[model samples]
Target chain A: MASKLLVDIHTHVYLPRYASLLRSRTSVPFIRSSTSRDGKLDERLLILDHEPSGGRPVGPQYWDRDEKLQFMDKHGIDVSVVSTANPWLDFLPASQASTLAKELNEDLEQYCSDSPILPNAPIKRLYGFGLLPLVPEITTKSLLDTVEQISKLPHLRGLIIGTQGVGKGLDDEALDPVWTAIEAAGLVVFIHPHYGVDNKAWGDKDNGHVLPLALGFPFETTIATTRLILSGVLDRFPSLRLLLAHSGGALPQLSSRLASCIDHDPVVASRLKHDARYYLGKLYLDAVAYGPEELGFASDVIARSGRYQTGASVTGPAVRSLGSQRMLFGTDHPFFPPLNSTEKWKSVVENLDAIDAVQGWTQTDRDGVRGGNAVALFNLVG
Target chain B: MASKLLVDIHTHVYLPRYASLLRSRTSVPFIRSSTSRDGKLDERLLILDHEPSGGRPVGPQYWDRDEKLQFMDKHGIDVSVVSTANPWLDFLPASQASTLAKELNEDLEQYCSDSPILPNAPIKRLYGFGLLPLVPEITTKSLLDTVEQISKLPHLRGLIIGTQGVGKGLDDEALDPVWTAIEAAGLVVFIHPHYGVDNKAWGDKDNGHVLPLALGFPFETTIATTRLILSGVLDRFPSLRLLLAHSGGALPQLSSRLASCIDHDPVVASRLKHDARYYLGKLYLDAVAYGPEELGFASDVIARSGRYQTGASVTGPAVRSLGSQRMLFGTDHPFFPPLNSTEKWKSVVENLDAIDAVQGWTQTDRDGVRGGNAVALFNLVG
Candidate 1:
């Protein structure tokens, strides 16, 4: 039997082409180089408005392949499925976004395919989730063409998207065809949050980016995914292979409330084919939540989604076998790197430790979350 | 041992005077009499903008004490701790809100104090949480005075408030005196949601009130509480005794992420005396979440918060004993009433059943959530 493979399905990368595109822009999403405290040069990626100190400091860890591989090796990560970071083409107009998306997709493919083979593993060390030009100006044909492009790329296993779909959000009817196309292509749709909820929700506190990054991002994903489910996208296309970042945000925690709301609402009660919790079982979640109890809770919600699918009572076994398999391990590298560069990233350690620590999980459950889930879901081969 | 008691800590009511006050207003929050489909006169409570057909249907269930008592008898609920529903004194001017708050406190005290004795339980079947004039124009003196009035009321054990504190959000420094007063008075502060996050987050979909009630209300609570924590309010007043509605919204699920974000942010990294998860254990969450899995998950989050209290590793003990004790059963009655009035309220049953069905909860855990916790928390006695 193959030894346990530690795959990271939620790591990220910014291809050189995409970085150059941002460097040329003068907007909030632009990358501006700045000097570190030690007199070394680093780039600041300003993605949101009113970002403190220009934006987050970006360095070789973001765009350098060797840095990613080294980070992987240092952390005992056997394989990484990387994707482009946020503000993904949302700032561009139609034609320019369409052109850049194609180029970036190719660059990502080349970046992954060019990676060296792992000494301990038979497969290449890197795989990628390509980007889509989901900007409003892009034509549906162009969008479908990009979907086709991503599907054909040998090393690209999925496509990463923000909450906004063609500028109207994931619930918009306009994106139904895109969902249909993605479903048909059999590529995993990685739903990540870029534009968090309105900043007004955070109030006037200068508590840095804690509220936005922690609450806003997750809340945004929860809202977007709930909207998508309420829109009957899941009901219409049951086979869509989608992956949610931040462990489905708060969806797993809020699924039962959402289902109750749907049941009580006269307008939406009869619209869904199954209980709202059922959809949770059907989707993939990155095990990026930092606590064992939460990870266990999320898995329970996912596992129980199966019962909801059958309209069965959810009072039986605490967890179904298939639910933990839907959760994949992720490091979210380059974003939450430790302040002390020599220390293991606390963010990564917390999630990995959570997988190990969650009660009721067998070694199989832990091993599955660590890598087997991603390998199976992404169809990764040696 | 005494018979297991079922206490509902999250039920709501609007006093006769408050109902009449709404009847006198012409704004969105004003109550209007309208004919139902069955041609019977019913009051429509419109609290938000663009509410469908004014707003939700509010009948005798909202303001009639006898109706509440009868409903409790039918559901086997031995005691209820009711608070004034949303938009509580938020729509009034400073002097008007202040005057009304005092009057409402007196009314709430009278309402609970006048309740009939329970046949099965030794205590009176009803208790109350008083209202505060949280409007922006209200003076700090008036706020403190209201807190004083509530503390002196025999039946009013806590004070219910919306996310807005003296106009600014809960994090506003202006609320420090109010928190200090509530803490000094030893009154539990029930933090509810009135103004959800900006509706723009819900997108263009018109899927009834699910988005706002299910997602927005909880999201609003999560943000407000997070802001309150980030501002060092908890650090300043550790024993403030906060009871959050809708199971702390998404706070438990997002607590670790919030801690991670705080650690990563240099400005707010050292702001709090404890980890974010510790704050959750310090809070009392209502078991208003609609499913057993969610209830269990929330309990786990609460229980494991102990480890984070001492900065201990959260890898051990899936659940701590004190955590489940912090949760109390809540019906959120008067709202989410059964559409088919002949049948039992599904909302109430879901919550009740959640307590019964949640895994790993001993009979003690179940009984505590059902009523024992509330009885102890509210200091109820025969």
Candidate 2:
């Protein structure tokens, strides 16, 4: 019998077309080459506008499909669902962003479709999540056209979005049409964080990128998603499938407090059809939280959300293991790579170990999170 | 055996002197009498500057000791560690804040010391956490003097401080002396949140205060406490006891992510002596999370910190119940009260129910969190 399948749903890639587009720019989010102290030329990818030391070194690992496959092979991953990395099409004009987003989506679709098929499984090794031109000047018609375009692509199963929606936040009512279109298309919406919270909250000490990457990024996702929930968008679009990065970015932990706050606010109490915890059960979460206890805890929150389902039984055995069914394994690869070239990536190893070590997670539950859930959620089988 | 004890460590109160002081002011953080729709006079408390509808109503429950005792009795709370509510002297001049801090400390002391002794216990029904003058202009000497004074007070067990410390955030090096003094005095520091993050993130929707109170408040606490952790304050003052409100305000959930970020940053990798998760074990958390899974998850995070201790065993049963030892019960009273005048507080009942429903918790574990943890932490058994 074949070993249990291992799927990575949170991996990222930068298509060559997109990289060349970034290289052509002269401002932030651009790529430039400089000489290293060892006398070798090095390419740097700078995404943040205010980054001083250029950005971290960039190479084939970012844009090469072969490098991703090789990395997956070394880590024993059977399948990967790739998406474009951050700051995607956020800075371009309507004309430029609209054109580039279409090209990138096609490039991503082709990139995944042409990948080698697995010998032991009846599926291709690669799948992709498309991008949207959510710029300030884009027309609603253009946005819907892109959604229509992605929905027809064979290998593209979802769309990756940042917190900023059409230059406002995700909660802005202006994005309602986009949500409706995406939901109707039956495509998953992968909500990620690119712009973190303001830097003033980090205080004076220069702690490198720890504050922004670790805390700010997740908190930004939390605020944006919570705003969307409070805006009654979930009530309006109950079938909208959202997969939150970093285990919903503290949302599961804060849902009960949120429910209590809503119950106390007369203006907000009657706004939703169900409690806040009910929404948590409805959403999918990537198991990227780096600890065993956290993974178990997030699954518990997701599973308990079953009790909040409409007409569902609130007692006993019914809600058990419901969370693991919704959680999918994620590597967040091409980011948080190890400094040493020969060493295994600690980021991937930590997540894998967490799944293995999580208490009360039976073999069936672990296998579900590791691959089976993604297969069911993304319809991976041909 | 006697029924398990119930102690509230996260409860709040407003001293009569402080109320009078606010009643005299005309700006935000002040209380003023206004006519209600029914023509009865109502005292409205305006804490946030931009609150349009005046603010929530204030009443005798805020300042009357008898009202507090009655509420405690109604909730079956045998002990309460009350602290002054938010915006505490934050708007006052340094001289005025210092004087009021001193006066308020004494009033709080008298309030707790004079409460009726519990019939089954060897302690009074009240204990308190005093306020600190943590405004923009407070002098260091006066701050230390208040710490010194609170240490000498019989009923005061800790100092309640806002996120801001001496104008800068909690990570400011300027407050190192205050940390030293408080640590030396063996006083617990109860860090709370008043100022949420900047408002622009909320967008154009009028979701009432749900966004700010539910997401903003806890996120603010998470950021402030994280800044403190990244600053290595816990490393400097290893024995300084901290009791974080809102179950460490997302700290336990995000600890692993923070540690991974620290490891990946070249500048931050070598800064701390231990991983970020270790500090979580060193602190105390109030059980105000409001959900069973969240409570269980936080305890697991806290308990696992035992593995990171200097010489403790990494495996075995040593850490099984360690987290319960550090988590204390709390009610956050006088806030989030029931809108219906005659009903019990949903806020209190939800938390109590959460404690009762948490999975894997033994009767002993529940008893510890309900009151034994507070008893041991505060030395309540004189």
Candidate 3:
């Protein structure tokens, strides 16, 4: 069997500077320390946890880039397209947001540039998707300027964004300029979800991270993308490329249902003209789905949907050819950290297992999902 | 191509009596009419819709059994194991709850028994999963008695239940006797979701039934079943056969994540020495998934999990040799109604397409999902 390269496109890091900013805040997304049951001083960060308790312990692993490189080495990840973990700059003051975004992007860029500082660093090892300032009351001009500045950042490939846009959502018409600028800059939008659905949906019992991490994250991704689709983001910016986390977050499974829904509603149908399946070919998906069966199914759906777009003039063959290149490997690292004391991250291994398990897949296809896709999409190896 | 016998085990009906009850009540789950822009009466229902206009139109097709038969015939469904639609006697007063359940079960029995009254009706064509009077604070004795009474009804095959159990969820220890009795009677428990996750998960946008129906329904099913697993219902009632709607409502997709979570949490791991994947084969799934690839993937996951039990024994093959017997056909009728003008139900046909799409599946396997599974599980033909 040929050895295939493994890439982690969805890995997260809290830069040292970013961590300091979070520590200065009193609200959520902050870190603190508490007494453990063993009588040891344990640090805790409160992102989702609600209480007067200080946030979860912020350690060197969270902010230190060397720690990230060391962890990647431990996991056998060849190249990681790291991005800033949420809630990223959404709460910044408008005046300071743009400068802070630049600082964060530069900080990330420097980390990627210094990738070879560590010994035994794998070939073509480090790359990044930069962050954007998405605070409310921020002018569109400022947002567009940030996009332009980040586009030129040498190691920066794309921008990672949350679902909430200026407090409303991605659907708000005000954010169109941002989309247009990103599309014009030929940058992929790494759309991830932060604020999950209402807590009431969880019911009375505390299921720990089961409800939020398992359901909330994906559910939020699905809703956000659906809203964008309904609001005509694809129709408006046909060239816009979005890399959805968690294998399009149930979109492939629900695409047929969504298409049927559009077909049933005459008002929506007349306004939308084409079906939801039509837009699916244009969208890019990540192989963050846990199992190989899911990965294969998602790939099959992409392949089948690509067939539908064959006849369209401008978008037909280009979009179809992009099918294999459309999906990249993503590991939601530092989040689903191994609770078990294993040396290797189980989360990362399961994802690699999925890539290995996709049957009848050519080595080229395997290479594409592992590292080649990210290389081509983000121009990573240049 | 060989002709496949398509069975629909997931279909639902409101029944005339149930519709009338809804009409009488002014609260949620009730029906009312509002004047449209053209001054015409626009009927609506308020389960997901919260407007004062109330719920959607409660038509004859929702309640009338003959209409259901006609729908089945039109769709070429060989057999349908029908169940009452959601909010099934869940709101009845305590004193009258069980009596009303008896009345409804009797009505369904008569309907199935007298199917000869319909034109060109086949013998023993219609069977049902009966309703449980789950509301009004019934005693454990009465609940068990109700299960016993329903089992004795000739046309009744099993019991249909919602997530809520005496106001708490399925995990509540108080519901142990109910699960025990239902398992002992060899009656299949058709677990469905009525109350979706909180509406706050849905942002302020009228996507017109997209969020609740698409995401909420499946998410609710996943949560309820996870609770059951965490509470060790499957461990105790090994014989309990659960037919999950919506292709186990994202259970197949999230099983890996759930297993990882259990492995990570000491509290969860301490309770059960076995892995979470070991419990999946003990449960059964319905073919309500909208696509063929999804169905195939779901089946593959069940097969690979290696959790199947012969009876109550947890240690065995991951899946039984009776693969098709474990899954049944379902249409989810009365809901997802065709918005377009068409004689054939699109929802039913899509599911049929899924059944036809599963690769390498044999005719016997197809037959079992179509009708034979329901027949054996519910003892319908015998």
Best by DockQ: 1
The lDDT for every candidate, in the order shown, is: 0.87, 0.86, 0.73
What's the lDDT for residue B346 in model 1?
94
Instruction: Give me the displacement of residue B75 in model 3, in angstroms.
Output: 1.8
Backbone-clash count (model 2): 0
Q: Candidate 3, residues B263-327: lDDT per residue as tens digits?
A: 55566656663566657667788988777656766676677655422233443322322454577
> Which candidate comes out best when scored by lDDT?
1
Model 3 alpha-carbon drift over 4 Å, by segment: A1-4, A34-41, A49-57, A117-124, A307-324, A340-342, B1-5, B33-44, B49-54, B117-123, B307-324, B339-342
lDDT of 2 by residue, B1-382 (tens): 1237899999888899999988998988889998879999899998875664568888999999999988998999999999998878888889999999999999999998888888977788899999888888788999999999999999999989888887779999989999999999999999888877777777777777777778778888888888888888988999999999899877788888998888888677676767788888888989998888888878888888766655666853224366877888898989999989788888999899888787778889899999988888887853
Which of the CAPRI classes, incorrect, acceptable, medium or high, describes model 3? acceptable
CA lDDT of A286 in candidate 2? 95
**Inter-residue clash pairs, candidate 2:** none
- lDDT for position A37 in model 1: 98
Fraction of the true interface contacts (Cα pairs closer than 8 Å across chains) found in each model: 0.79, 0.75, 0.32
lDDT of 1 by residue, B258-306 (tens): 8889888877967788878888888899999998878887888888776
Worst 10 residues of 2 chain A by lDDT: A312-321
